[model samples]
Target: MGFISNVTGTLSDSISSELKDQHLETFRTDSLGQDILVKRAVRQNSFGRNQGSSEIISAGSKVIIPAGTYALMIDNGKIVDSVTEPGIYTWENSSSGSILSGGVKSVMGDVFDRFRFAGEVTKSQRIYFVNGLEIMNQTSNESLHLPYPDPVYGTLYFKFKIMFSFRIVDPVRFFKKTGKATTVYDYMGSPALPKQPFTEVQDHMEEALNLCGSRDKVPFPQLLSNKSKLKDAVNETISEVWYEQRGMVVESIAMTGLTLDEASRKRVEQFDSAKIFADDPAALQALVALGLTKAMNSAASNPAGAMTGFAGLGMAGTVAGNIQNGVSAFGGQSVTGPETCPFCGTPLPLQKPLEYCPACNADIRSYFQGMS
Candidate 1:
């Protein structure tokens, strides 16, 4: 029979306490830490070894399920009973027909088969407590590099570390899928558990970041502050693997130590320098004047006579003056450039047509293909 729920203080006082220490009656778990994912329940009697299922769990036995945990009873290598709510339960051994009852299916053979004896199912009975508290893993030290579309800087490669917290939402699925039956399942310490899902998250990082950059309009540098958007994007990408299959969900994700790669940083600086002269006619004229002074010095040192050098220089000076006159004809109005990325709506700092949209990495060739 499955474990039956018992109301508090409902156990009758008429029962005799004559043979108290002979068999284990009560099962409960001690304090569980944050990182401990699962632990086997402790039988009340410590001195005597439990030789059989009867000695381990008997009729009229009590199971104390505390808050923030789930308890499941394994009988004959199958999970026959479980209690998700926090309460006292009474074990009734009247019938075995309730095997795998209470909406919990039998434990998958492939997972718990290793505990069987010589290819035979044992009569062993035990209860395991799965931690229900939120489990926070260590901050991943490995850097995740992704292409980010910045309004001001265009497309930039961002390098950052990640941290996240998850919790077991379905104990049955978790126990069935985990395979290993350790006395205590530590989420962070598990070799296979952490790597598979985290690697999936890393593999899908680019897709998620693209969603943030394009759909959410989140800037590259603001990701650290916009934890909710980043968390949602990642969860949406890996939900099938982590939530649907594994019965766990990423509750929160923090993107930390965010920075642009060296090449991307230099590109931003170069763009900014060029953008200043492209927008400001006065600044461009000043720069042109400085170049002319340097050219005049080189012309005086020419092997050709100074008069010939001056004559050529005078022609160049006339061209420079005409360009300055054209600038003045604009009535000192500031020169304007291309303002935004066509694909993702990110602001553009440069006026000239680019081969690629910096914000979304969309090929600009298609946008300008038929232009004059």
Candidate 2:
């Protein structure tokens, strides 16, 4: 048979064959002129042959030329391979040409190029503000009113210097969920100025500390005695606030230092003084003793002095004696002793127990007996 007639006969036979029974095969030539077979289903325009050095025309088979390659001719459902370089080739669908081109390339070669979709990345970290830590972020004028003004507030400016660290956990989720690393910054950073102003996180921290202080009604001196506990309470409250509100976990919070403003410091010092005097049983007892002595001396000097001054002494002595007896009953020491005549060291009698010294006959007791 002649070359043209033979090719036509083959084409007719292939075209007439049932597609369900016969499968079509595709081939393309490399730069080395090696024929490589690519298997695909037979379809319209599935055949082609090299019509020229740079082109192949297919009449029934679809073909994939590499990104920078060309096609020449087509015939039947088989590809007549003829080419001049190493590149990707696939059987293209006439209806969905090159739809699976990448798939074919991946099958034939290593598909190492990867595409990833990322949204946002977020990181969480912990900060520590040690006890007595002075925070620099707070403005000098800003102040918090703690419930126990004596222990925590009163013209006191608190400042703390804190250490903070952060790390990324769910990078993709952080990016997608939060949108930026700064989301955490915004969550933790100081709020705006003027209305909220710049208060150290430690200020809030201290406030939380003072909230726990409310559990005790004792004075500041008593609270300060357990300063370690105060610090722990502060750390706990601040950490909880951060975790619950911002969805960030706290690793550690410490207070590096604690300070009191000048005015508050002075007030605290004064309070300390008052506390010392108020708490001293000995001093209180001495005051009571002196007053009783004075009344006894007076009664002794004025024989008929109506004894009113001695009456006050008698009442005070009774109350003091009862207090002493109660203390002794409780295994505690007595602060005051018996009321006596200042002139002779003799025990006095009340008018109700005659408020006068019988031996020295003195009048000496006029004084305030309750807390001043």
Q: What TM-score, computed on C-alpha atoms, does each candidate reach?
A: 0.56, 0.30
Q: Please, what are the lDDT tens digits per residue for candidate 1 over residues 1-372?
A: 132223111221111111221243678885455756777776776656433334235444678988888887876567778788898887664122222233112223211332332223323566788877777754555777888876556788978877777777888777777643432333444433445556777788888888888888886557778888888898899888887888777788887787888999899788877988768878878877987898799789878988888888887776565456545545355323334445554443344667875435777765555453
lDDT tens per residue, model 2, 88-136: 3443322111112333342212111111111111111111111111122
| Overall local distance difference test of candidate 1 | 0.64
Error of 2 at 192 (Å): 8.8
Please name the candidate that would achieve the greatest lDDT relative to the true structure.
1
User: Which residue pairs come into collision in candidate 1?
Assistant: none
How many pairs of residues collide in model 1? 0
lDDT of 1 at 41: 74
Q: Which lDDT value does model 1 have at 69?
A: 85
